[model samples]
Target: MSFRVFGIDAVSYSTYSRLQKGLHAISMMIIVWLMTSGYFAAYITRIPEVKEAVSAFNVALATLFAPVFVFRMCVSFGKGYADVLRSNDVMRYAAFVVHNLIYITTLIVIVSGFLMVNRDIDVFGLFYIPAVITDPRLHRWFSDSHTLACYGLALLLFMHVAAVIKHHLTGRPVLKGMFF
Candidate 1:
């Protein structure tokens, strides 16, 4: 609030600016939780006896959040271009929305991965499911889906961070939305 650019006060963006900033921060915290849970499910529980448990955790998370991500993306389409475009005031929301989409889409990848893993057991020690297959016939299918999803997410994230940096270099409030 103290800073001004070209004598133009930050008020030009209006009060939604602060609310939007808060949303961005909250969204990020949620994503961190989602990713942490995913990492634990995917990488930490590696025992064959409990492998299905971890994969099941990822599946539940994905199925639950997938709809939420779709809803968010759908809402973004309704936003006015002026409001949605890359402005410092809006960048956090934009970044948050973009990553939410990424996280949500990855749900499909995770589910597909569990199928690919081909183990049948109770996931997270709750639900019992049969193994997908003993043979690796569908290995390529799962690998391709998971790999492609990760690569796409990585590219989108890179472009996103780059845009924020660009906004900062150009003296926009891009960093402000994320930090404060």
Candidate 2:
């Protein structure tokens, strides 16, 4: 009666745990890089090639990351919502909310990135995803929202990491649950 990842009946906790860990690690690394990429591009723009390279890299990373993230979101919330609700802990619920927000914001940022005009992206060096937005107003709006969402994601990530460290320091095995 429950949703399963890939409809596999015997999927173990260890399997989902590993999937979450890998996806989380990838998400964190990409986000951290993306947070600074704007500033980095500005600084290196004197060499126009570097700016182009940076833009291409950003698009490529997002292209590869999108599906993995979407998959993780699907698998993570499947059947876990009931467990989260039944736990009856405010902190756990808060953590779940923060996690969902992080995922939502990241997806928003990714979509906005895709919508932004002027950047030509050869995703994974195979196919190109062109900028479909040409309206200056809408483009600016999405671009600005993408930037804000990146900042919000950074803040959420900091809070999440701090909570994990706090749990580890306070001898709550919740941090260990993430690993084993």
Candidate 3:
């Protein structure tokens, strides 16, 4: 569905903002999926097909989401956006904390999968990032970090959704300000 607000015919945000938001949504969904997939990978690592598919998905998601995240971080410093972020400093701070939590969690997830697999893992059999170093300690650390981050992310995401719902139900202009 397209984004619309009040009487404005435009989508929820500008083209760039929409793309950023779309990526945000896609990345979030994929990350959630990857978390579950990681559990499956851990329990069913013996399943060749499950391992291969999960590994490929992990690599592709990492590759796709990284640039989108980088761009979002860059644009976050631009003018005008500050106004939207200022709706409520307390909540805005909470959102910032949540964003960072997601970012760190995302990085750990990618790092874990990359470390767990051999350098030969390829996405779509087209691109690859060969592991430069091998140490079981490093891989295990990444995996454990990824697991912890995912647990924290669950709480962060819950708070974020709750805040959004609060804004919507409170009849505040917060959601509107974000799109404008």
Candidate 4:
């Protein structure tokens, strides 16, 4: 469960199961793509066509990702909570807090994204999901919530990456634990 990288012993310090690792990898890839493309469409684009395309794609992607994300949440939360409660390390507790915040914000983002939809969700033209809220006012509120939660999730993801880099640079190589 350990290997050498650049002449250093990279030990697998994580006890995550194969299922957890797989789920994490899937969720991470989708979330990162969604967030990056979303920000690009919102802040970097002036073309209406480009913005609409990105928006439509992201909504479809997110709709499909929802169930996988919920499953990931279910698998992760119990183990993480138990580990933090059993550990006396302050860093573990800190990581737990940040991790939970990320999960919560992600949940909010997904839910609000769904609720904010003013029209039916067309998932890659496979099927259509009916709009949950009919009120424009409620849709606007959920849209705002989704935006704020996305920003919060971005910050948390940054901290998460920074922490992993810090660990790796310090010889902990915690990043290796999450990989095969």
Q: After superposition, how far is residue 144 of candidate 3 from its true place, in Å?
A: 0.9
Alpha-carbon lDDT, every model = 0.58, 0.74, 0.64, 0.89
TM-score of 4: 0.94
Tens digits of lDDT, candidate 2, 1-180? 322332323222342477787777777777778767855885546778888778778778887888888887887766477788899899889988998898898888888877775566788768887668778889889878877877787788899889977865654534434443
Q: Runs in model 4 with CA error above 4 Å?
A: none
Quote model 2's TM-score: 0.79
lDDT tens readout by residue for model 4, 26-128: 9999999999999999899999999989999999999999999999988886886776888999998999999889989998999998899899989999999
lDDT for 147 (candidate 1): 61
- What's the lDDT for residue 29 in model 3? 76
Query: TM-score per candidate, in order?
Result: 0.52, 0.79, 0.67, 0.94
Which digits, one per residue and each the tens of the lDDT, describe model 3 over residues 69-179? 666656554534466477667766666667667666666656655666546655566776677458878767776776776677667777777887786666543455444
Among residues 3 or more apart in sequence or in different chains, the pairs in candidate 2 whose N, CA or C atoms overlap within 3 Å are: none
Considering summed lDDT, which 10 consecutive residues are worst modelled in model 4?
Answer: 5-14
lDDT of 3: 0.64
Candidate 3 has its poorest 10 consecutive residues by lDDT at 7-16
**Model 2 residue 105 lDDT score:** 86
Q: Model 3: clashing residue pairs? A: none
Query: Best TM-score goes to which candidate?
Result: 4
